[model samples]
Target: MTDSTKPTVLIVGGGIGGVALGMLLHKAGVPFEIYERATTVKPLGTAMNFNATTAVMMKQCGVYDEFMAVAKPFSAVQVGNTHRTIDYKIDFSEQEELFGAKGFIISRPDIYDLLVRQVPKEHFHLGKKVISSEQTNEGVILRFSDGTTAEGHILVGADGAYSSIRQHMYDQLKKEGRLPATDGEPLPFSSLCLVGQTKSLDPSVFPSLALDESQVMTVLIKDTPYACSIFTTKKNTVAWAVGEILDENRSKEGEKNEEWGPGAAEAMCQLSRDFPVISGGEKPLTMGDLIDWTDKDYITKVMLEEKVFETWYDGRIVLLGDACHKINPAGGAGATNAVHDAVTIANWIHALPPNPTKQEIESYFEEYKKERLPKAKEAYDSSRMFKSISSKSYLGWIAAVCFKHMPSWMNRTLLSSMMAYRPTVSFLPDAEDKGTVKPAHQHSLETRRILKERQEAATTAAVKA
Candidate 1:
């Protein structure tokens, strides 16, 4: 258990970023607590994709073994027209080789569960909704919807896109007239996505489809607002989807949003039953199979949103993940980037001295922003580009040819160059250790001492063995 007297971090949101940050702080011997709005951390989403960069970080965190055991690792992505007129595939084997890691596709809840279990129950507070925050020279205080308050040495907003912490931070900045020109813009949406995972289907049903192989296949309808991406796992199931941006999918403006729960799951199933996702081999696999196999509770519908905020921090409060930069799911950076932020931000916090002054805290946050903002922009740009290139435009056509129709060897060289640039966790043993941006006088001496002792113990045990 964390000592109450120790310097503590209050992490808002209980998703991937919040839990991962708690886990890392625990490793650094830092006291921290996670506050989440959800009463229970159930499997919340359908499917998730992984690339080499994220894979390496997961391995470093010691969750790779378990993640791999449950996920389907894919080495390529296949894009084709729904009519089977044009079929193309991009092989990622060489890219995986370059990054020293393979890619994976897994159920979102399965991965979420794995991350949650690593953080102790004592560190988390479920059913707690953070509404606002106030900070002074000493530390920060959080105000919850239930009229309760939480005081901590630092406040990190790992909340999602509709982050209350972010809104509070922005409000404070504007009140100070530091951001008189900024706009809290809403995300623009061009497409709607319906996602769900079905019970394991027989690979024999779709000839040429190999079970247990790692790969992504996408079906696009030309000249129409329709597309579906499927990730097949050896676990006897497929995560599939059919998406469109029709008016029927959009919510009326100025209306409060209530979650479209599992009751809407059946609606998606009905719409997808006859929609074909892949027309390969003698028999085409239609969305009907997926809808029929998946439970009503597993389907989800959402308007895909992508954006990056210009400001990320103010005083003792800072932002991470979707709170600051929301990304399209095309590149699968959504969850990976969130976890990466947790580690990077934890590193900066780990460098902070006990009872740090306001100036010291602000400076460290500035340093954190310097390292992260560019990476967030890159993800935002890439995800936006991916969304566009998945369409029927000339650029999309060129991408399909260059990515899928190209030779296998050429494909590896082309994709790996892009894959290798992805951002990863910064605190792993093999990770690049750029020590705190703060001066040596403000360094985390206790953290350094503990880290040294751990290193020495490992050496001693090895020598004794």
Candidate 2:
């Protein structure tokens, strides 16, 4: 295809989704540019858990090897009360053996760096925030905050939760009287999460911690002020996130702004004093003993009620990732689902006929929506449910106690479904199928072969030494 005929995708936001999408399109021989709102692509948040689906996409983007170079692998997930062991520990090694791939816990910047390295420097324009976009019969026009304009065949609102492109699309649809009515009240879960990170703990003392350089470790302290602590180790640096559920209504209405309000450290400390965990073979557990409370800083995020837009596509512009669906981070599925959107879109666009018409593009967008919306909703609902289950008062405590005694197989089964989810589009054959979907195992086999080769080479090097 000539330069003029090449399909151009204008991706908003330089976060994980946008950059990963750009990398996929580039690998597919498609021309695209990622316009990031940030002045520079720096590490934005703490760590993120990359399940199997996203790991497959990262592998396809040719950055899986790069990720393996720096990321740590999670062998098991431990969940229990502060004082005693829980039966809910999940050992992913066998599952990884079964699936032929392992999950990774890496810093957000590590994945971003891998993607940015694959993309051509010229194609990524930093500090170019998209202000508005206009769809035409031929293509779409994007106007940016820097007072510049660029036209492309399609525009992707990978800009994230507060997407300007999505707003613009909704406004245009409303003007044409095609928008859907607002759904009832937002999600009922009103809680704020304080996310923060700290210096790596000494592995000798915190032997239970997964400091494997790539594994993500989650500690659920029952009947404690701290609801959960999610930590992922990356090289010498270890990233941690602590979340305290808050009253969402009060935070939203601007009633409470204290750094340590109702569900702050002090409250957690009080809870710890009430329910002591038997640690180091001792009694009367303290908050300082459980976590490094003094050294860590926390960022408070009031969990907004979950809001799913009535629609994700308008004419030629479409929403991807957090732009269309916002899920609670209780399950760490938001980032994974967002990355899946990027891959799904790229695969759909690649499957279209060469030099397709505008109608063809719209059709592709429709198919993309039909396939992805359910999966996005599933992740959203699962996050809400998990949060509800985790935060129940008395009944929740009973269930949590029961979960501690559940069989290992049951817990593994539950987590496997979430961690191994692959979009429907990823399994399609390239111009050679009768449309029957391939089993997920086939893809797992491919991943296994690659991983095995890398392992063998490592073993050989070690033996030589």
Candidate 3:
């Protein structure tokens, strides 16, 4: 049963981030309903890498063990050229020893399914395309395309890059001249990506499929506009992607924007099919082989864009995940960052006062943004840096060389900064800090402790009276 004192949360969009937040809120005993525009969930995209940044929260939610089952361990990435010559390797083997958590790679849909099961079926509503949203002193309301309405105390826009909720919020803010000029601008994308996963292959055919650790092999052809890569999965399948780095102006002017769907990927797949891959097999492979092995219905093409919004919350409506920040996937941190946002947002909501006032709710939102904004920017910067290094330009070459030969101390410092921010739900027994490097300060955890102490003291005095 829900405590009437706690605010009921309405989350828009049923992506991984939204579902993740729903799971946390459920575990914390808070009421939340997730609304997705699509009637059925079609798990798209390739795969994602999750490390200490989110493993602690998964454990707190009691899903870490299942997550481990669905995911393959990730240790290092082998980068090379189309000629099959090794360039450099990005090592992650030290992550576990330094951060006290192992990194894993899992198919996007597999993890989504795991998280979705944690929430009750009734709480996750589908076919609810939210057209617009409005909030008042009493609560917030969402009007769907089908003319139905739902009300809740808090509204969270977890929609993707082209978020309708964000457009509506900006529309209102723009009319009042409160929205930043940058926020009103359209999202710009430069790179086009084709992502898909092959069916489970024979271990004899692909030797790497038998390994415990997911082997990531990437090939960057010199002076070419494309980068192709493949990853081994725990299920004996291989996930692959081909990214075409386009000139920003050229892409915006000449190319038709590619939407993320099945048929949309065919064109890009054809263009990159001939690109070479360094799969650890008896013979060399090409992107075409993997493309042919993958089911056409599961492939998707999308335009990669990066942006961090200035306004995350106004009134009772707040935004999380891709709705607020869209980062390139080149750094493999986009999903991790989204998961981090969900964790922080859930923490704040869980710590809220019973029947929180509008001012109090907004204050919590403010704190959530304050804690996540810098981290989002850091991820954004790291993504762009990685994207640049993966490109075929002269600058990309220089960046890659520098990274390959970076001093050990410098490399450790950089890795530490990115890996030291593990946060758990404040409502649960926090995950033990086992890393040699202590985690960064968490505002929500500190706030929850103080609030708990105050409530206990008040209860003692009332009992004595």
| lDDT (Cα, tens digit) per residue for candidate 2, span 1-465 | 445556788888777788778877887678888888888654545677776666555555446678888777776655555545444544555545444456777767677787778889999998897777898878899898888999888889988767888888887777878887672223344455544444555544444343343434444556543554445555544454445454544545432445445556455444433333322232443334444532333333344445666588766777888788877776678888888788778766765555657787788778777767877887887676555544646655665565557677776666555654554334223222221222233222232344456568879999999
Worst 10 residues of 2 by lDDT: 430-439
Ranking by TM-score: 3, 1, 2
- Cα displacement (angstroms), candidate 1, residue 263, comes to 6.8
Model 1 RMSD vs true structure:
6.7
- lDDT tens readout by residue for model 1, 1-465: 235434688999999888888888877678889999988765546678776656645666788889889888777677777675448666766545566666788878777888888888899898899777888888999888889999988889998888888888888777877763544666555566788887766667654346457547777866666777777765756777776643334524312234355555567667656666763456766888777777766677776666788888887888989998888887777887787677668777776655667787788788777777776787777675566556666766677656655676675555654455444444456443222211112122234464566578879999999
TM per candidate comes to 0.84, 0.77, 0.96
Q: Which candidate wins on lDDT?
A: 3
RMSD of each: 6.7, 10.0, 2.0
Write candidate 3's Cα lDDT for 1-465 as tens digits: 239798999999889889989988888888899999999888677888888788888887778889998899988777888788778877777788778788898988898999889989999999999988998998999999999999999999999988888888899999999999999877777688889999989977778888889988778867678888777888888898888777967566423543444456776777787888776665877888898899988888777777999999987888988899999988888888888888888888887887888998899999999999999999998888778866877878887887788777777687788888887688888776578888888777766776778689879999999
Q: Please identify model 1 stretches exceeding 4 Å from their true place.
A: 1-6, 84-86, 180-183, 202-210, 245-268, 279-282, 404-417, 421-428, 431-465
Query: What number of clashing residue pairs does each candidate have, in the order they appear?
Result: 5, 7, 0
User: Candidate 1, overall lDDT?
Assistant: 0.71
Best by TM-score: 3
- Pairs that collide, model 3: none
lDDT of 1 at 259: 36
Better model by TM-score: candidate 1 vs candidate 2: 1
The C-alpha lDDT values of all candidates are: 0.71, 0.63, 0.85
